[model samples]
Target: MAVTDKSVLYQHGTLSLLVPGLFEGTMTIGELLQHGNSGIGTVQDFNGEMVILDGHAYQVVETGEVHELTAEQSVPFATVHFDDPKVTTHETKLTKADVEQKLLTDYPYKNVFYAVKIRGIFSHMLTRVVQKQEKPYPNLTESTKTQPKFKQENVEGTLIGYYAPELFQGVAVAGYHVHFLSNDHSIGGHVLDYTLAEGDVSIQPFASLQQHFPLEDPAFLKEDFNYAGMSTSINKAEK
Candidate 1:
């Protein structure tokens, strides 16, 4: 699994490096946190968006196709800790350890969290819920712009997972709620291509759809989302 310059590794999306031994494509921050021995590679895009590692990209294409990137450069994934606030500051110096300590002393049970707000289509089927990714194609904004429940200091690392707020907020399909990925907060910058389905429960119906997204947090997704619960038909048509 040694990486060589001539390896010509394959990736999940557009950007990623060639990993050596690590596979599985995706891991919850908590999972990787517990096992730090795991090796990591650059993120890349295949036919769909996926986290690329070593030689293999971690993802599943509804159609069967794996894409390898032509450009060659090392992609860096920083495990940062924010003692300040979660604002637009990409330039910082912090490691995974620093963020972990902040969470242990802050958030309850030493769990990580994100203060979120739902500002789109609330009190109805279209309520936009922006978690790791913004919702409501038109209004891609942070609802907790002014005041975030999960204060910047309370949590650690950027969010990279999804949440189904039914755990914290009542299930009326309204407002925004923080979804927990894993506590890893290590994974970032992933792109995935999505296709349409026959019967989706959400607002719109997507026939041929593709979405480019990133999983910035290292935490594992909240169980409340439970796959079926989290799978909602986004009004992707607007996009």
Candidate 2:
């Protein structure tokens, strides 16, 4: 696929972008909506999981319930793109790693970001939702220790994710960062691992990026944001 400005990655905040004191959320749901129609992110207080598809944002709480964002809900971190990816559908057996490997191998574009959407019925799926945190929040790696995990069988859902360039290390996960939303909408969260019995995977590569930083928040402006060991912290938090 040829790279073009028509495809742009719109991102808000950064992974471990705020280290000393994590800002709860700097951008509201309404504000994020203007950027793109599809992507994944975490909600304020790290209370639950967020998956945006088809221009609507849905919050999946720790209890495994999915809710649509209302009022001025916000997020400290999110990645979205105006997705209209080239579509390809196939029936095959694959694991989470297999899906990622296949995409990278087929596309083989390491420098650009790809908006990925995979829908299928899973033979096995494992997912985790981060717990809500109180003020004086801990770093992301520490916060994941309390994340509630669930396993489901014979489930159908869509996997929303992105493949980021390794060059964007501290800024993004640098690899596959994916979240899951089940067909029933009752069960979904940050994907840990899964076995897809059958599914369709679509990929759209973006040659450009547009980032929005939250400067209005006092904490964002004041925090020193120690970057020491950020690579280790992000690896632990994502897995």
Candidate 3:
């Protein structure tokens, strides 16, 4: 993979689109990697959780089974950037809340974006992967209602994701959005909660964001998005 600017975030599709059930994939995994190596997203039709780490992509299905994705695989939404952390902090025994708080307190930037990576042993990890949706797909909130959640204890893995400001809520997740992948590639999914046994938290702040839309998709072009309920649905689905 070619090196990309660590200071820039590349995103495909808007979070708002998923609010009204526009789950069709617009970009292939190969095209996504051309922009970055570490990030998070969902596969086409919200089939599974996606984690891009060390220049490779992995899909964690509803059953908590991990599979490395082929280049031809696609996604409807994703955020990626070459991860080159300028700050690395060693944290121990930190809960999910503590980690989020620390990241907020340490950086204290409300408008900019941050790429985050945490690698270590986790005492407890709670994650969920939404099931694949067929045609007449339900909105994100409804589709996630039957999501399969997984709980793992004392596992070593890495967390990959980004932090978007509240001002860009409909464009991306307003807060930390991360996914987990185990070292052995046996289990992983969208991170709901976790307790870090000990780990290194690395972060890279970015001031630039490049948003790309699926202009070729007719559904994306014609759908009347529910801007008013986007935040509400996003919050519900994310939490």
Predictions in order: lDDT: 0.21, 0.82, 0.89
- Count of backbone collisions in candidate 1: 36
What are the TM-scores, per candidate, against the unseen true structure? 0.18, 0.93, 0.97
Query: Candidate 1: RMSD over Cα atoms?
Result: 20.6
Instruction: Name the TM-score of candidate 3.
Output: 0.97
User: Model 2, poorest ten-residue lDDT window?
Assistant: 1-10
Can you give the lDDT of residue 25 in candidate 3?
88
Candidate 2 lDDT over residue span 7-80, tens digit each: 88888988766344374888888878778778898888887888998888999999999999963989998988
Sort by lDDT, best first: what order?
3, 2, 1
Name the weakest run of 10 consecutive residues (lDDT summed) in model 1: 197-206
What value of lDDT does candidate 3 attain over all alpha carbons?
Answer: 0.89
Point out where model 1 deviates above 4 Å.
Answer: 1-47, 55-59, 68-110, 113-239
Model 2: clashing residue pairs? none
> Over the full model, what C-alpha lDDT does candidate 1 score relative to the true structure?
0.21
lDDT of 1 by residue, 92-162 (tens): 33332333233334434212223221111111011111122222211111221221111112222222211
